[model samples]
Target chain A: MYTSLFYKEWIKTRRPLLLLSAVFAATVAYILLNVAKLYQANPVALWEFIVQNNAAQAGYLKYLTLGAGIALALVQLAPEMQNKRLKLTLHLPLNESKIVGSILWFGIVALTGLYLASGAILLAGLTVYFPAEIVSANLLAMLPWMLGGLAAYLFAAWICLEPVWRQRVLYTIPALGCTSLFYLDALPGAYLPFVPWLASLTVAGFAFPFYSAIRFKQGVQ
Target chain B: MNAIIQCENITHYYGNRLIYENLNFEVMPGKILGLLGKNGTGKTTIINILTGFLKPRAGVCRIFGEAMERLTPAAKSRIGLLLEGHIQHTYFNIEQIEKFYSRFFPKWKREAYYELLKRLQVTSTQKISAMSCGQRSQVALGLLFAQDPDLLILDDFSMGLDPGYRRLFVEYLREYITAENKTVFLTSHIIQDMEQLIDDCIIMDYGRILLHEPAAHILNHFRRFRFTSDADEIAPADGTLWHTEKVGNNWETYSFASAADVQRTLADGGAAVSGLAEERLSLEDAFIGLTGKY
Candidate 1:
């Protein structure tokens, strides 16, 4: 049953997922090519500049992950809400909670795979021109942004699953507030100490969609 | 035999406005019951509550002897639902949707679905979103038939269909239900189409049910009586006649009473009756007569 549910989710999301993947790849390639050009011009100066200014050199990738997360959730979930189509899904011959959980799990798993591949490419690309310390630092700096992206996906699910427009607007305030914490500082290692808290927030975001699903089942308007 | 669908004293409100109160109805096995009502009379509301999408304010609905709000998966498997507008996952192609739904149902009838789809000029790879309203309705009906549920709840089945599609739907549905002895509960604004399909009906007025009887009974018993009177005014007692309108010397009213009884009642009300006639009504006329064509 879960596999079938995932299959439906995959059908709805595969197009947007592919589009986001292309965008991610182009963004990563653009960031890496710029880094290569700078290294070719003067490798010592680039390293000295990075060490002194604590620049992650991947600032352009900041909102790219977050946007991917939000886009994936919309493609995966918006169809279910259209024309109150979720009623058809909820009416399926399965436990409603299990059905909703499977849908969310599919989106989360898909997003995780995309993020890992994109992050890995960025890490490996930088390793060729820089030492291990700078590569590790760059990876750490982007970690919170990726976590923020996951949180945004879950939060977007909550908003889209909401049955009422007014309540959805109300939910966005808190969702935006919580996700903002992931971008407080973009410097390398700055978010390392707050990683646990951000991860906790992402975990907590998963529960919000269930609350919305409950309201949807209750026919709140 | 237990009722396939039952509702006890369902009361509901939208904010301060009351949609209905103490509303009650039941659908017995092998019976196709149609809920007929004007706009905002809680026809779809009842469907929503029965399917557990909307929680009523003051009552419980049970399907197959289980509370609607907590229907087990086993119970859910025995029911099929068609939402308003025949809504489905428009993103999926014809074949993909079948593949998606076939996994969950133990009794999924793949041939039943394809048999209906064969009537349409659509390919297996065609997306449902690209279909017209009529075509979408066919797909929805095909899916419901494929589910092979014991009870089917359809909301506004005839909403967007042309005459040809409507006839096709009613004929197909009636044939299927008769062959399988399936119970059906549905609503439609098109009373003529419903007349050819429904075995029984629940006609609803605002906040209450006006009548619940077999379609044959309403067609055979309830009628319109027109008479010419010489008196200046003719007014029968309130309960004896409905929507009485007097134009010039002709008077028209509707009731379940016989022509003799109507004449007697009008004579007692001090009107001199001359030519009196009772006219048989179609289901649409009967509906309008009972509910006062407002």
Candidate 2:
């Protein structure tokens, strides 16, 4: 049964997942290509330039990662909400919580996988020109952005499953507030001390979708 | 016979407006029961309660001898549901959806589903979203049949179906019920399709059950009566009469009692039964008579 569910979701999400991954990878490659071209222009100035303006690089990636999270959540949940098709899955013999949890988890996994893949490629590409410290610093800076992506996915799922437009807007407020914390300071590795707690909290954001699914089953508005 | 479905004192409300109070009904084993009501009369509300989609404000509903809200996975496997508007996972095509649902049901009958699908002029590769409303309904029904459940609950099955499609769907359902002898609980405002299909019925009006009896019994005992009365006079308020509406000086009343009983009630009320005639009524007429034309 679990395999069937996974396969069903795979079919529905495969197109969007591929398209999103391609778009993200292209953005990362474009940024790195510019970085490499700058390094070729003046080796000494390139290193100094990146070290001083590292936060600007982080800013570019942060918004991209957040956008990816919102896209994944929309791709996974919007159709189910469209015609109240979620009721079809709720009618299955499986537990309601388990069904909704599985969907949220799947989105999280897919988002994390794509985010990590793009991040790794960019890291490896940068390593050829920059020192290990700079490369690792950039990776640390990207962690909070990825965390924001997961949080956004969960929050968007909650918003999509919510029946009332008013409640959905209410949910978005807290989600935006939570995500804003990750973007507060763009210093490379600034959130490193809090990564463990942030990761745990990001995972806990999944509970919102569960609550939404329950209210949906109850036909609440 | 065992009660496949039961609701006791099922009271529900939307905010402060009471939709129904102390509403009760049952679906006996192997019997097809139709919950008939006009728009906003709580037919769909009863269905939602039974399906555990909406928990009633008060009262309890049991399916297969267990509370619907807490039915176990095994208990759920014994039931089949066809939601309103014949909603399905439009993402998957015919073969893909069948394969997906086949794993969840222990008694999944692939051939049963395919056999029904064959009757439709749709390809196995056709996605449900692209199909017409009638085609999608057939697919939904086919999926339920493949599950081979002990009970079937269908809500507003005729929502967007054309006349020919509606008839086809009803015929297929009738054949399935007769062959399997499974219990069915359905709600439909469209009465003609359900007239010959339901073994028993519960008609609702003004948040109350107007009639609950075997179809044969309701047909035999309950009837419509028209009698002319003086303009200043009112019709008799007898317990047996379910609803009464007057057009000009002529009064039409629906009664659960026999024709003779109706005449006796009118005569006792000091209203002469001079033009009293028992009008033949189909189930649709009986529904409108019980729920009135609003």
Candidate 3:
């Protein structure tokens, strides 16, 4: 049952997943090429600037990661919302929670995988031109952005699964408010001290979709 | 025999407006029951309640002896649901959908699904989203057939089909139900199609169930009566008559009473009647007669 559920999710989401992967790969490559140009101009100056300013060269990644989360959520969940098609999923001969869980689980796992690959590529590219301190600072800066992506994905699911428009609007407020915390400062390691809080917020966001699913099942209008 | 589906005193409201109150009905085993109602009379509401999508304000609905709101996965396996407009997961192609659903049911009839698809004349790789509404309906029906469920709950199955597809659906469903003796509870705006399919019916009015009986009984017993009367105003003295109206000197009404009883009741109401006639009605005519044209 779980395999079939994932298979159905995969069918609905594979196209968007592929499209997002290509875009993310292209964006990461572009970021790496920019950093390489800076290193070629003056490697010593680039290293000193990075060490002194504590900045991650890849600022474009912030919105790319966030946009990927939002886009993936919309593609994965908006179809289910159309024509109340989620009823088909709920009607399957399985536990309703398990069905809902498997759907969210698939999106979360897919997003996590994409984020991991993109982050790994970014880190590996930086390692070739910079020392450990610069790479570690980049990693620290990127972690919160990835957590923000996860939070955005889950929040989008909550809003999309919500059956009523008024409630969905209300949900969007917190969705925006909460995800904005990850972008308060762009400098490398700026959010490192608050990483645990940001991660906690992302973890808590997973529960919101289940609440929306419950309302949907109750036929709230 | 236990009822295949039962609703006891089901009451529900939309915010402050009452959709229905203390509504009750049951579908007996092997009986094909149709829920007939004018729009906004809570037909879909009942379907939602029965399927555990909408929790009612009061009362309980049980399917296969389990509460609908808490149906076990085993219980759900025995039921097939067709939503309004024959909605399905349109993202998957014909074959992919079949493969996706086949894993859930132990008694999945893959041949049954493909057999119906062959009639659609579409390739297995064609996505359901690309099909016309009628074609989508057939796919939904084909999926239901493949599930091989014991109970089928269909909501407004005739909403978006041409006559040919509607006839095909009704005929195919009739044959399947008869051959398998499956219990079906369904509603359709097209009462003529339902007339041919339903063995029993529950006609609903605003906030209540107006009538619940076998379709054969309703057709054989209930009738429309038209008579020309000399009196200026004729009215039924009792509640037996439904939707009594006067057009010129001609009076028409629907009732379950016999011709003799109707004549007596009119005479008692002080009408001098002539050219009294009884009209045997189709289910659609009977429905309008019972519920009125308004």
Candidate 4:
């Protein structure tokens, strides 16, 4: 049942998601090429990239990996809510947590895939143009950040979609706060887990709201 | 007959606003219960709560004697529901929906699904998005029949269907009920269409159940009485009160009980009476009488 929900969500979202992915890939490719050119033409840009990204690998991972997670999260749920299709799913004599959680799971998987593709392109650019500071450990360390971002994204979705006005506005404010954290890129690991505004704004994202089966029970008869 | 569904004081509230309160009702085995309600009534809300789609604020409900919240596999297996609107993943063809649902419901009968597909005259390959509104509505009914449930709950039965399909569906449903002794609960705007099929009806308004009785009883006991009353309104002590309207110095009152009590009262008041005739109660009249608003 869980897998079917995921598969259904995938079938519904795969087209636009893949299309957006292709667009994201093109944009990332452009950014990577531009970064390489800046490094060769004016060494100052090289110092700037190092200063910005090398400070904390989590910050870079939180923004890029979480951004990817945000896209996937939106791809999974936004249309369902907009079209009121979630009612169809919830009406069935099934567990809402798993139904909603399965969509979240698909989003996490999709984001992980995006991270793999984007990371490859970024890594290749670093290897050819500037290999001085790009380490494999630094790359490996971004996994927690990616997972954390995914959790935060799902958490925001849960709170925002309470099917009531107060909860709707309630879910909206926290989401705004988290997205702001992602944009600022200065959020530390200690604060990331609590950032309900987004999926990747925290340390492990699990702390934000990890599909607490408790929530669905209260709502359905 | 055993009650397949029972609700005691089932009250539902959205935030602080009470949609309905103190709702008590039941559907007995081998009986088709018709839910009659005007627009904005809580008919759909009750269905949603029973199907476990929406929660009630305070109430104890049992399906097959098991609490709804528990919703065991055995209990859930026995219940089937079709919400007010016909919903489908428009991009998916009817066959795809059939295939997907077949996997979900453990007791789903493949042969019955095909049989219903033929009976409903729906092509398996027709995508829901591509189908006309009426065809999609038929497809929704097709899915419900495929489940072969013991307790079936439907909301707005004839909302978007043509008269021809409506008659065919009712005929098919009648046979299905007789053959299987299944319990059916339906809410619809057009009570006339279901007048022959439903065994009993519960009239609802503003989330309140105003009346519950056998369809035959409603037909036999209730009537419309037109009389002239100089007073603004006359409240009769006895009989089922339906609705009242003032025309000039006269009043036309529709009552579920025999009009003898109300007619005698108006005559006792010494008001000039004419058109003192008994009118047959249409479903629309029964609805208006029960809800006051058309």
Backbone clash pairs for candidate 2 read none
Instruction: Name the lDDT of candidate 4.
Output: 0.67
lDDT (Cα, tens digit) per residue for candidate 4, span B54-82: 67888978889887766775576577776
If scored against the real structure, what TM-score would every candidate get? Answer: 0.97, 0.95, 0.98, 0.81
The sequence of per-residue lDDT tens digits that candidate 1 reaches over residues B91-194 is 99999999998887889999999999999999999999999999999999999889999999999999989999999999999999999999999999999989
RMSD for each model, in Å, please? Answer: 1.4, 1.8, 1.4, 4.6
Error of 2 at A6 (Å): 1.3
Worst 10 residues of 4 chain B by lDDT: B234-243
TM-score, ranked from best to worst = 3, 1, 2, 4
lDDT of 3 by residue, B65-171 (tens): 99989888999999999999999888999999999999999999999999998999799999999999999999999999999999999999999999999999999
What DockQ does each listed candidate score? 0.89, 0.76, 0.86, 0.25
lDDT of 4 at B38: 77
Clashes (candidate 4):
10
What is the overall TM-score of model 2 with all chains considered together? 0.95
- Candidate 4 pairs with clashing backbones: A149-A199, A149-A200, A152-A198, A152-A199, A153-A199, A178-A197, A192-A202, A193-A202, A193-A203, B242-B289
Question: How do the residues B1-294 of candidate 2 rate in per-residue lDDT, one tens digit apiece?
Answer: 668998999889998889999988888899999989888887878888888888889999999888978777888899998888998999999999999999999999999999989988999999988999999999999999999999999999999999998998999999999999989999876899889699999888767897798877777766898887763465666677756667776888888777888878877877665587787778888777767788
lDDT per residue for candidate 1 within A52-133, as digits (tens), equals 6586866767888789888888998899999999999999989999989999899889888888998899989988988898
Candidate 4, DockQ score (0 to 1): 0.25
Best by lDDT: 3
DockQ class, candidate 1: high
Off by over 4 Å in 1: A48-53, B230-235, B247-249
Clashing pairs in 1: none
All candidates' chain B TM-scores are 0.97, 0.94, 0.98, 0.89
